[model samples]
Target: MAAPSSQIDQLADRIERLLVRYEELQRTNALLQQQVDSLTQERESLKSRLSAARARVDALLERLPTLKNAA
Candidate 1:
């Protein structure tokens, strides 16, 4: 025996809702992955900048003795 038309319609609606929720979850996962990638790149860039700044400071410190002798 076949299911009543009303029951089949209800099942179809439930399936459609589940599909929509699945799609939403997929989109959320993709966005989170992008955020992680962006944060990783930013961290690397900050580390590079910090290293360059430290090198500049070290060079200036090395010149201090010569400047003191010349004064």
Candidate 2:
């Protein structure tokens, strides 16, 4: 009977510990998710800027053809 009681108490303690660890993991996961969202937004902003720059470069290249004809 004593052995059984001890085993039950140990199991209870393990369950409590596992619950606490799970909570900690949940908080960490939430933080990581927020960071990923922020990074994705930043990536999109950079992509937009890059696209604008490429367009400007293409416009400049197109002008070069006209300039060459005038020369």
lDDT of each: 0.95, 0.96
Model 1 accuracy (lDDT, Cα): 0.95
> Residue-wise lDDT of candidate 1 within 1-71, one digit each (tens)?
56799899989999999999999999999999999999999999999999999999999988777865988
- Judge candidate 2 at residue 30 and give its lDDT: 100
Scored against the true structure, residue 23 in model 1 reaches a CA lDDT of 100
Runs of candidate 1 with Cα error greater than 4 angstroms are 1-11, 66-71
Best model per TM-score: 2
Local lDDT at 57 for model 1: 100
TM-score of each: 0.66, 0.85
4-54: candidate 2 lDDT, tens digit per residue: 989999999999999999999999999999999999999999999999999
Off by over 4 Å in 2: 66-71
